[model samples]
Target: MRIAVPVFPGSNCDHDAYHALKHVVGVDTAFVWHKRSSLEGFDAVVIPGGFTYGDYLRCGAMAKLSPVMDAVRRFAEGGGPVIGICNGFQILLESGLLPGAMMVNESLRFVCEYVHLRAETGRTPFTGGIAPGTVLKIPVAHYQGNYFADDATLAALEERRQVVFRYCDPSGDPTAGSNPNGSARNIAGICNERGNVLGMMPHPERCSEEELGSADGRRLFDSMVAWLKEKGK
Candidate 1:
């Protein structure tokens, strides 16, 4: 399957994502400039992490208006799978493709380190290859990664099992102390109601290699590929 990795002016992780998907995951991937108006011919799209547009105004506020975003929205609405990492997650929120918003870390500092994430559900294409409650060692680098949503929205997410991942301790316990960014309910990642879009604070591409300290992130990409193949996409 062909994957499109969109590159905004300040998207630093676009190359990393391309390498991970193309070399590590062995998928056909290419970079799509921010000015591109169409996302046709791509089976999946990934919005990698970075300080888009210098994070002006807010983390993803400016990047949300990129010309390519319109196509991203249309692609997503058409049931194409979309995954956003770090700042990309913020953009997804800003574009209203996903619910909730991001806030500065509870510690009021930029957090960059490896954190444990537990698969909250295996029903979504993003996590279908992993077992529920499986803990993964992934790295997160972001200043505004704190996820926040209203009580009703959180309740709806929980009710529909849309919560894909949650920050947790090594033993898979999602305690307050394990929440590095103080996301609500220790949330680390979530999927849209249709399960076609995913937004997460962690950078999975950074951990998809064994030499990179861990290869647990590969499971997520593998799950996506498997799901797409199953659907003949």
Candidate 2:
């Protein structure tokens, strides 16, 4: 599998994302700067977690207009697999690669720590290895992670199984109180209508090692690599 991880001015997690793919998954990974205009021959792309552009202009709003995002948009529209984590998720929303918008945390403060996420979709390449209701303990760190959409959109997402993860407690019980940033319906992740584009608030690469207390995040990346291999065969 070949993965392209984009790096913006303040994209602190790009290296970690690249490491996870290169070391944990043993795949060919490259760090692509935001100025680049095309994605070349990569099979998949990961917009890693971080405070891009210092989160200066509403989380990912500023980075959304970066030159590389045009290619990212093209990649997603072409049905290529694209995963956006945290700020990357925000960029997807801003770029219209995915639907909805992010808002300030209900508490209006930054949140950072390990949280629980329940898998809500299995049809996407990103979550194929995880069963429905599979509970993953992953780390989430962000300030503007709250997700919001209108009633019709939310209903459509639920009806289509486009929602991929919901915030929950360690016991696997969904709870708004457990929500790290007050995402609507406790949603921590979602996929585009076609299921090829995914955006989530949690950092999967951060939990790829057992030493991080959970290896659940690895399953997401592993599933993508395996899915690609299967497609090739």
Candidate 3:
């Protein structure tokens, strides 16, 4: 199956994502420019991390208005699997493709390090191969990574099992100390109600290979590939 990796002006992880999916994951992948208007030939899309618009206008505020976002929105609405990483997640939030908003880190500092993520659910296209409570080692690099949601939305996410990944200790416990950004509910990743769109702060593409100290992130992409392949059949 073919997948698309959209590239914004300041996107630094587009190549990383392309490498992870093409060379590592062995999937046919392409880069969709920010000005592109259609996702006509793609099966899925991955919005990689970076300082979109130099992180001006509040992270993704200005980037959300990019022409490509409309296509991304249309693709998501059509049930296409979409994954947003770091700043890309911020863009999705701004585009209303996902719920919640991000704030500065609790430490009031940029966080850049590998952290453990516990899979909270496996029902989504991005986590179908992971069992609940499975801990994965992935790196996260961002300043505004703290995820915040209203109590009602939080409750609904939990009840619907849309909370896919959570920050946790290596032992798989979601402890307060393990929360790097101090996000509400320790949420590191989540899916929309349809389970096709996923957004997370971790840089999965950077850690998808074993030489990078961890290959756990590959499993996330693998899950999406498997789901798309199965759906095609």
**Model 2's TM-score against the true structure:** 0.97
Model 1: per-residue Cα lDDT at residue 173: 98
lDDT of 3 by residue, 1-233 (tens): 78999999999999999999999999999999999989998999999999989988788998899999999999999999999999989999989899999999999999999999999988878889999989999999999999999999999999988898999999999999999998999999989999999999998899999999999999999999999989982
Minimum summed lDDT over a 10-residue window in model 2 is located at 49-58
lDDT of 2 at 229: 93
Each candidate structure's TM-score, on Cα atoms with residue i matched to residue i, is 0.98, 0.97, 0.98
| C-alpha RMSD for every candidate | 0.8, 1.1, 0.9
Please say which candidate is ahead in lDDT: 2 or 3.
3
lDDT of each: 0.93, 0.91, 0.93
lDDT of 2 by residue, 1-233 (tens): 57999999999889889988999889999999999999988889999888888888688989999999999989888888999999999999998888899999998988889999999888898998899988999998888889999999999999988999999988778987799887889999999989999999999999999987888899999999988998891
Candidate 1 accuracy as lDDT: 0.93
Deviation from truth (RMSD, Å), model 3 = 0.9
Off by over 4 Å in 3: none
